[model samples]
Target: MIGSMPILLPVLEPDAKEGDGKEDDSGDDGQRLANRCFVIGPDGGIIARYDKIHLFDVSLGAGESYRESRTYQGGAQAVLADIGPAKLGLSICYDLRFPYLYRALAQAGADILSIPAAFTETTGRAHWHVLLRARAIETGCFVMAPAQSGHHADGRDTFGHSLLVDPWGEVLVDAGRDRGVSLFTIDLDAVAAARARIPALGHDRPLTI
Candidate 1:
């Protein structure tokens, strides 16, 4: 788990400029912000890149509305990258609510998952910890969540409490209600042990809708 300090004011792209009535320039401005994924291999080579899939677009108190989709383009696929002894799965903020995506990645052999988010204070307070722990328990995988905290240049506030959880629903490292990176030396044996105990993935039953 590596949580960096909140990005106060990320540079907005020229194409991501708001208030432009033309749809052709709808997502131009968001391209300016740096939303990239670097899959560092055991031999130290960047093997894959997975951009964010969802945008933060909501209305808070007092008629304040944010439309992130206006500036950013959604990612097309979920990425599973190999980094030394771990198969890491990548995701971002809003992707937490979607369990199917995570399940698909786990099925594809992801043992460690990464969810780097810039979550809002309201939602984070309500659901962040629970959702993260749940994802870990459900998939029987280790979860690393690096977050963006504090206020941003756009006047939006973010709740940052990055966490690193083991496969058995235990938080190994918690970066409390502040900033900075939180690191942990994960044990792959824990993943194997947890999966051996529960074996939920092998017993997944097809539900009929």
Candidate 2:
């Protein structure tokens, strides 16, 4: 799965003025930032683009810490796009932790949710499959996750096992702990059937607690 494309944006100094003798390096020649995901149409055209709202910023102990916000700016909006057969909700790695985002996408008419990730071995083993299945069951939408597996050049080991979960929370396919391609067919009609049976998405009531 392709992650977000990093784009360069100009960084401006707020305090520096024109005659302050500070270097004039604004506009087009600044820093490379922006975690953006895109939906490319069959015609090789851009259909939709989404910036990843959630950034991975945590310390897993053992001196391992990630500060994604250091170089990349988090996205502010969630994007939904129509890809012919199904309306897709676009998201990147860390977005899986937030179920509300998936629920909102389903309510907004998204039938398929794409969450491409490179999860660490620790968290993936603990929560990956469970979370993916839960999301599908909760939203009655198909969950398609393509993950990065095995070791990388950066000296970090990733947890693989890419999964495709159906609307009923059934795992249609799992890619195991290695890097490989997996194929599976989904019935979009099942989305409606599952939601019809549970009807939980429409059962929300205001809470006073």
Candidate 3:
């Protein structure tokens, strides 16, 4: 999801469809727009927009504390978008730690997942890559994560290893703690192949205690 910002949006109609995202004149304005991601399709129109569901609210003692919920309301819905080659699921940084959400998206036919994160340097260094790879492996979906790197003007640091992980849990590209771009061709077939080989998504059983 794009970083935090207060956005003013127009009111939406009840008859609104999925292909185009519409907002209106009777503005609904606030910090809701900040923590969201949009999937633009081949035709250059907005196909889907997913608001970030999980907020980062943790007290990392020694004065290192973050309260994302203080700024914005978390999203109440999960969205999967049609992006021609694959059904892409949208989620933000903190949501990556929740596997059940990814499983729900996969069940809804998502073959590719996007995580746009502004992760803190401490936790990102420890859990970022591994968690992303695990999600890809479990869902058999290609995971594309674009992250915020280096330092922000507020004197905070981010662990900026923007990763592209394959369905087979391979690191295709890692944008390591630098302000730059990483581009690669995503082979959709790899998703199919990996899922066919492992089929882990199909093996899920009910949680029985």
Candidate 4:
């Protein structure tokens, strides 16, 4: 059984009326809160939570569309947490596309990155592997992605190729189109070794906007 539910990171949007004392209804904000992942310690207690800053919104095919920003709020802060043996960076699905977020996490000393997703079959088939490997290579961190696969009772199908990538951009394990567990050992030392060889993280200079 799961230990607990997600911790919410609330976002605030400007109200329509701007300044009439009741511009935005505070009551409804909770419904549009951030998608967060709790960093659970090995002892089964909650240590920290990272609210998903990027929401998934796209049109896949005929009669398939999603608008997460309409239903869920976007998070503004990036968080890093320690989970016993590893320093992990927390993020959800769509956040994977944003490099800045992962860089920030790596800069904060994350050895591993966890991304939990229910990725649509269409996009996942095309981009999942490439993106996950890129992030791992760029940040020199191991990536742990647990995903949803197969068609659900609601007739919605997800492409599940859950991946475990090492710091050297190697696909250590892949749970391809199956609903099961994939086990592998993560050597955190690899993170340090890879970073030491490439050292790209330290050499990046802020680009002038």
Candidate 5:
């Protein structure tokens, strides 16, 4: 597995009173609300740990609400860890929306990127595949997204289609709507070849907007 920092946070107690002055109907803590990391070596032994930088806490209608800020602390820095021949860039779900982060990772020599997410069904269905492909095409890096699938204990549904995309914006492998591990062997040479062909990373002209 890629060695990146996880943005960790603590779980918070629910608010005592609702707008109706009734007991709030929040569920028990079933998930570990912390940013945690596990470094798996070639032999499959953990080698490091890094916390996540961002948290997901929002109410997406239908009485669904989350407040991750109340539970976990935001991560302070980005993690760039070495994994075999690749410099892996680590990020979570919402982080994918920010292109600058991916650009920075590319500039920092990241050949592979990981974005593990529990995306909402609505957003994932609309933009998940397109966004993943775009990032891969833009950065010339392999993007591996192992996502949380199906409904959670809290009655929240997540879009679960774990994807592995290559530098040329090709879908290498897709684990569709399942709760199991998927393995893939990616050739690192593809990154260099793609970057060499396009050379977009070196063509940054100051433009007047």
Candidate 6:
């Protein structure tokens, strides 16, 4: 559900291709493509959709840089949906780095966080596991991430280690660098137990910056 989807360009704006790396102010400063994720119910209906709020715009050395904002528009709002057994929070790839969004979702009653991503080989090798585990530990919510692996059509490589982490920061499943389906069982009761033991989510206080 996390992938490329195109949107109509604003009438007064000029068309800019995906890899242009040019700044765009049209479409209210949004991109022509959206990095969107969806929540689907078991009955084959769409429950909710979340456009990624954080775009991947970084330099990875070797004269390599990505400007996702040039092609994909970032979402302005966080989304939470009811998926029968649990309340789910929807987020696309780059949004994983933003811990505040996940915390807000957890505070808003999300039992599971879905972060589907296409992380590059470089960053994924370094920060993938730690970040995912950190988010689960911080929020006490089960995390289910599905990532793209191997070479891509754009001459870029992705680090694919699809993961499922429990609320207690236990890795239930780790689908290594391959293309296949991974299945794991998650116990929803663990969420409440973890939170009851830590209780960090309830300890937040207003701070002055």
| Best-matching candidate per lDDT | 6
lDDT value, residue 168 of candidate 2 = 97
Which lDDT values do the candidates have, in the order given?
Answer: 0.74, 0.80, 0.77, 0.79, 0.73, 0.81
Report the poorest 10 consecutive residues by lDDT, candidate 3.
4-13
In candidate 6, where is summed lDDT lowest over 10 consecutive residues? 2-11
Considering TM-score, which of the candidate structures 3 and 5 is the better prediction for this target? 3
What TM-score goes with each of the models? 0.80, 0.83, 0.82, 0.82, 0.77, 0.86
Range of the 10 consecutive residues with the lowest summed lDDT in candidate 5: 9-18
- lDDT (10s digit) by residue, model 2, range 65-131: 8876555556678989887767998888899999999999999999999888889988899999999
- Residue 96, candidate 6: alpha-carbon lDDT: 94
Candidate 4: pairs in clash: none
Q: Candidate 2, overall lDDT? A: 0.80
Model 6 over residues 99-172: C-alpha lDDT tens digits? 99999999999999888888999999999999999999999999988888999888899999999999989899
Could you tell me the lDDT of residue 82 within candidate 3?
Answer: 73
- lDDT tens string, model 5, 1-209? 23332322112322322133433234544222446554556556554444556667677777777776555444556766677567888777777887878888888889988888878887889988999999999999999888888988888789989899999999998898888877667889999999999878778779896
Q: Mind sharing the TM-score for model 5? A: 0.77
Model 3, residue 76: distance off in Å is 1.0
Which model scores highest in TM-score? 6
Candidate 1 matches the true fold with a TM-score of 0.80
Give the per-residue lDDT of model 1 (tens digit) for 1-209.
12321111122233333333436445343353435566554455556767766667778768667777665656667888776566878887788888888888888888988887877878888989999998998888899887778988978688888899888999888897786765467788888899899988778787997
Ten residues in sequence with the least summed lDDT for candidate 1: 1-10
lDDT of 4 by residue, 25-139 (tens): 4445435555667765545667887667787778877988887766566666787876656777888899999998999999999999888888888888999999999999999
